[model samples]
Target: MARIAVIGAGMGAMAAAARLAVAGHRVVVYERGETYGGAVRRFERDGFSFDTGPGLLTLPAVYRDLFVKTGKQPLEECVDLVQVDPSSRHVFPDGTEVALPNASRAGVVQALEAALGAGVGDRWGDFLVRAREAWDRTRRPLLEEPLWTDWQVLAEREPYPAVPHKRLLRTRRAGTLAEIAAWELRDPRLTALLDSHALAYGLDPRDVPASAAVLPYMEHAFGTWYVRGGIRELARAVYERCVARRVEFVFGAEVTRIVEKDGWAAGLELADGTVTEADHVVAGVDPGRLRGLTKHALDEDGDVFPDASAPSPGRFTVLLALRGAREAEAAHRTVVHTPDRGAELNWVSGEGPGPVRPTVTVLRPDDPALRPDEEHESVVLTATARPKGDWAADGSSKPFVEMMVHEAGAAIPGLRERILWQETRTPGHNGDETGAFCGGMPAPSLAGGKGYFLRPSNSTRLPGLYRVGGWSHPGGGLPHAGMSGALVAGLIVEGPGFRGSQ
Candidate 1:
C-alpha cells in the first residue's frame, strides 16, 4: 500500500483520506489548525449556534456517494439531511417579493409570474430549459471526469446553446450572461434574479459566460438542503468517516515545506521541525498556500491558478441573535436585491468602493438547535466582498453589517429592535482562520477563456504531488470539494487512467 500525506483537514482532504484508507493506503492528514472542516465552522454563544461557512448544501448526492463508498451506512444515517421547501425568497429593490418553491419548476414559474406580472414566468421557464442544455453538455467533462490535458477544448467551447436573436436586421447569439438577461428576459426584475445567482459566488455576471446559466439550473434540479444542526455537522460526519477508515490526523501541524527527493514529493516538513515521509502528497489548500509550501514555480500552461492581477473574493457575514421567536411564515432563506446593480458589480470587481447598498442574503433556519429557546432566534446575513483591503478593520464590516440588517428588515419585521447581539465575520477573519490568501473563497469552475473554467489538475509536475479541494479541479462549493476528493483518490489508487468516479 502506498503511503499518502494530505495537507489540510478540510472536507476535501478528509474525503480523500477516507477513500484512500478504504483502498488500503496508509493515509496521514496534517492540518495547521486544531479542528477539521476548514471553513465549515460553527459559532455558539448563550446556547445559540450559527454556521460561519456555507449555510446550505446543494447536490447532496455527492456526499451520499462518499459515505456509501466508504462504509455501509449512507449519508442520511450519519446526518439529518432535510430538503428546504420554497428554496428561497427574493425581495426585489422595488418591494416585489416572491418565494420560490424548492425543486419545483412549475411552482417557481407561477410564483414569479404572480409577483413580477404576467409573461415573466414563461420567459424564466424558457431560460431554465436552455440552462438544462448547458448542464448536460458540460456536466461530464467538468464534474464527472478529470480536467482534460486539452482542456482548451472545454474552455474555447461555450456549452450554453444560445437562442438566435434578430435585432436591426442582424442575427446574433448571446455570449455573456448580461446579454441573455437583457435580450431574452427583457425585465429588470428578471435581470436581477439572474445576476443574483452569479453575484452570490462573487462572479460579475456581466462578464461571466452564458454557460453560467447552469448555476441556477443545478439548484433547481437537485434542490437545496440543510443539515440538522448546521453545515458543521456535515464536516463532523466526514471527519468521523476518515477516522473510521483508519486515517491518522495530526492537528496543529503546520506544513512549512514539501520535501522533494529525486524530483518527486517525498514528504512534508512542519513548522515545529518535524518531517513525515510519504509516497504521495495530496494538497487541499488554496493554490497560493500550495505554492508557498513547495517553493516551486508553476508552469504557466500546466496549472490552473487564479489570475494574479485580480484578487479573489470572500464572504462578509453578520450573525444575529434576536430576542423574538422566528415567525411561522418566515422563509428559510431570503435574498434582498440591491437597488443599483451596476454600482455593486463595479465595487466588487475592484472598480470603486462597493455600493452603499449591496445585495444581501439572509438565512434564518427554523430548527430549534440554533436558538436558545422558542423565544429566541438566530439569523445570518451574508454578502460577497473582496478578500483584501481594510474589510477586516474594526469599523470596516460594521457599516456593511448595518446596511445588510437594514435591507434584511424587509424580510424580518422589526429587525433592528429585535436584536439581542450581533457578530461579524470578515474576509480577513476567514484568512486568519482558514489560511486562505486574503481570505478569498474560490468560485466553481465555468466554461470559457481557454479553459479558465478549469482548476489546477489533480496531478502536478512533481511526480508524487497532487491537489484536491475547492482550489483544485472542479473548483469550490461543498459538492465540488467532495467531488475533488473522489477524483484525487481515483487518480491515486486507479492511476492516470482513472477517468472519474462512476
Candidate 2:
C-alpha cells in the first residue's frame, strides 16, 4: 500500500483520506488549524451557536455514497438529515413573494403562477426543462468524472441547449445567462430569480455561460437539506468516519513545503521542520497555497491552475442571537432580492463599490440545538463579496449588514430589536481561518466559455502530486468538494486510467 500524505483536514481532503485508507493505503492528514473542518466551522457563545459556513446541503447523495463506501452506517445514521420544506422563499423587488416547494416541479410552478401571473410559471417551467438538458449533458464530465486531458473540448463546447429564438430575420440562441433571462423569461422578477442562482456562487450572470442554468436545476432536482445541529455536525461525522477507518490526523501541523525527488513529489516538510515521506501527495487547499508549498510553477494549460489575478468571491456573514423562538410556519431559508440587480452584480464582481441595497440570504433553522432553549433563536445573514478590499477598515460591510437586516425585516418582525448580540465574519477572517487565498470561496465547476467553469485538474505536472478540494477539479460547494475527494482517491488507488466513481 502506498503511503499517502494529504494537506489540510478540509472536507475534500478528509474524504480522500478516508477512501484511500479503506483501499488499504496508509493516509495521514495535516491541518494548520486545530479543527478538522475547513470553512465548515461553528461559533458558540453563551449557549448560542451558529454555522459560519454553508447552511444547507444539496445533493446529499454525494456524502451518502462516501459513508456507504467507507463505513457500515449510512449518512443518515451518522447525522440527522432533514429535508427543508418550501425549499426557499423569495422576496422580489416588486413586492411579489413565492415559496417554492422542495424537489417538486409541479408545486414550484403552481407557487410561481399564484404569485407572479398566468404565463410566468410556464415560462420558468420551460426554462427548467432546458436546464435539465444542460445538467444531463454535463453532469458526467463536470461532476462524475475527472477533468479530461483535452479539456479544451469542454471549454469550446457549450452544454446548455439554448432555446431557438427568432429575432426578425435571424434565429439566435442565448450565449449568456442574461440573454436567456431577457429573451426567454421576459419578466424582471423572473430575471432576478434566474440571476440570483449565479450571483450566489459569485459568478456574474451577465457574462456567465447559459450552462449556469444547471445551478438552479441542481437545487430544484436534489432538494435542500439541513443537519440536526448545524452543518458543522456533518463535518464532525466525516472526521469521525476517517478516524474509524484508521486515517491519522495531526492538527496545528502546518505544512511548509512539498518535497520533490527527481521531479516527483517525495514528501511534505512541516512548519516544525519535520519531514514526512510519502509515496504520493494530495493537496486540498487553494491553488495559491498549493503553489507556495511546492515552490514550482504549474503547467500553462490553465486547466489545473486557474488565473491567480481573478480571485474567487468570498462570503460576508452576520450571525445574530435573538430573544424569541422561531415561528413554526416560517420557511427555513429566505432570499431577499435586491431592487437593482445591475448594481449588486457590479459590486460583487469587483466592478463597483456595491449598492446600498444588496441581495441577502437569511437562514433561520428551527433546530433547538443552536440556541439555549426553545425560547431563543439563532439567525444567519450572508451576502457575496469580492476577496479584496478592507471590509473592516472602511466600515463598508457595516452598512451592508444594516441593509441586509432591514431587508430581512420582511422575514423576521422586529428583527433589530430582537437581537441579543451580533457577530460579523469577513473575507479576511475566512482567509485566516481556512487558509483560502484572500479568503475567497470557490464556486462549483461549470461548462461553457472554453472551460471557464473548469477548475484545476486533479493531476499535476509532477508525477505523484494530486489536488482534491473546492479549488480543484469539480470545484466548490459541500457536495462538489466531496466529489473532488472521490475523484482524487479514484485516480490514486485505481491509477490514472480510473475514469470516475461508478
Candidate 3:
C-alpha cells in the first residue's frame, strides 16, 4: 500500500482519499479552509444556511459506485436524495416557459412543444438521442476509466459511426456555443436558451463547444436531484466516508508546497511549516496551482500538469438565505433571458479588477433544513465571467459588499425583501481558500468536446500523484468528481503488478 497525502479535502480530495484508504493506502488529506467541501461548501448566518456552491446534484449512481467500490454504502450515511422533478424551467426572452423533464423524454418534449412550438419537440428528441449515444459511448471508456494515456480512453469512447472517432474531430481552432446552437435549432429564442445552458459551468454559449449539446440531454435523461439536507451536506458525507475508511484529515492546515526528494514526490509541507512524508501525493486542488505547491525537482524536460488544453470558465456567486420561498410559476431551476431588454452587462461597467463583468447563476436551495423559522428558503443567484478580484476591492472594502448586494436584489425579482441573509463570493475567494483554482473555466470548457473521449485523463505528471474534483478528471461538478475518484483508485490498484485490467 502506498503512503499517500491528499492535498485537499474538498469533494475531489476527499473522494480520492477515501478510495485510496479503502484500497489499503495510508492516506491523509490537508485542507486550508475552516470548512471543507471546496466548491460544494455551505455557510450559515442569522439562523440561515446557504450552500455557497454546487447547489444541486445529479447522477447519484456515480457516487454510490464510489462508496460501494470502496466497500461501503453511500445512501446509508450521507443523504436520502429526492429526484428534483421538472428538472428545471427555461424562461425565454419572449416570456415563454419550458419545463424540462424531471427524467422523462415525453414530458419534456411536450413542454417544449407547448412553449417553443410543434417541430421543437422533434428536434429536441433527436438532439437528446445523439447526446445519449455520446453518454453511452463515452461514460465508461472516457469518464469511468483511468487516464493511463490521454487518447487511449478517448479512442475507446469515440469508436463511432459503428467505428473510429476520426470523423468527430473538428479541425476548427476554436468552437463556440453560438455556432453549435445555430447548427441544431432555428429559432433565435430556442438557440439562445440552448447557448445559455453553457452558463451551467460559467461558459458563454458563444464561446463553448457544440458538443456540449449533451448537457440538457443528460439532465433530462438521468434527472436533476436534491439531497435531503443542504447541498453542503454532500461534502460532509464524503468526508465522513473518508474517516470511516481510515483516511486522516488535517483540516484548516493549508498546504504551502509539495516537497520532492530525488525528483520524486516526497511529501507535503503545510503553511505552518509542518512536513509529512508520503510515497504518493494527490493534489485534489487545481492543476494550474500544482506547480506552485510542489517543491520543484528540476526536470530535464519542464513538463508539468500545465493547465488543461482549455481551463473551465469561472464566475461570481451570491447565496441568499431567504425568509420564505418565492412562489415561482416555474420549476426550481430557471434560466431567464432578455429579448433585447435592458440590463446587458450594464450593472458592471468600469468595475472589477480585471475591468470585467460577471454573469449570474441563480439556484434555489432544495434543502428543507436551511432556515430556522417556518418556511425556510434559499436562493442561489449566479451568472458567469466576472472580474475575480474586484469584489469588495480585494475583498476588504466595505462599500463593495453593500454595492454588490444591492445590485443582486435589483437584478432579480423579489430578491432583496425575501433575503434574510446574504453573502457574495468571487472566484478569487474560492481560489485563495482552495489554492487559487476553479476560477477560470468550468470542466466543460476543458472537458466538453466533439471528442470528449479525448478529455484529460486522471493521471498527474508527478509520480504517485492523482487528481479529482471540479478541476480534474471527469471534470467539475459533483457527479463527475465522484467518478474521477473511483476511476483513479481503480487505476492505482491496477499498478505495475496488477492482478486485473481496469
Encode model 3's per-residue lDDT on 415-502: one tens digit a residue. Answer: 6777666677766666666664435544531333343423344565566666666666566678777776776666676763322224
Query: TM-score of every model?
Result: 0.97, 0.98, 0.82
Whole-model Cα lDDT per candidate?
Answer: 0.88, 0.89, 0.62
Error of 3 at 145 (Å): 1.5
Residue range 25-121, candidate 2, lDDT tens digits: 9999989999988899999998999999999999999999999999999999999999999999999988889999999888899999999999999
- Arranged by lDDT with the best first, the candidates are 2, 1, 3
Instruction: Mark the 10 consecutive residues where model 1 has the least summed lDDT.
Output: 300-309
Instruction: Please say which candidate is ahead in TM-score: 1 or 3.
Output: 1
Q: After superposition, how far is residue 170 of candidate 2 from its true place, in Å?
A: 6.5
lDDT of residue 75 for candidate 2: 96
- In candidate 3, clashing pairs total 24
List residue ranges in candidate 1 displaced over 4 A: 166-171, 300-305, 308-310, 392-394
| 280-368: candidate 1 lDDT, tens digit per residue | 99999878778888865554445444663356878988999999889999999999999998988888888877536788999999989
Q: Where does model 3 exceed 4 Å of error?
A: 148-176, 295-312, 324-330, 338-361, 394-417, 445-456, 496-502
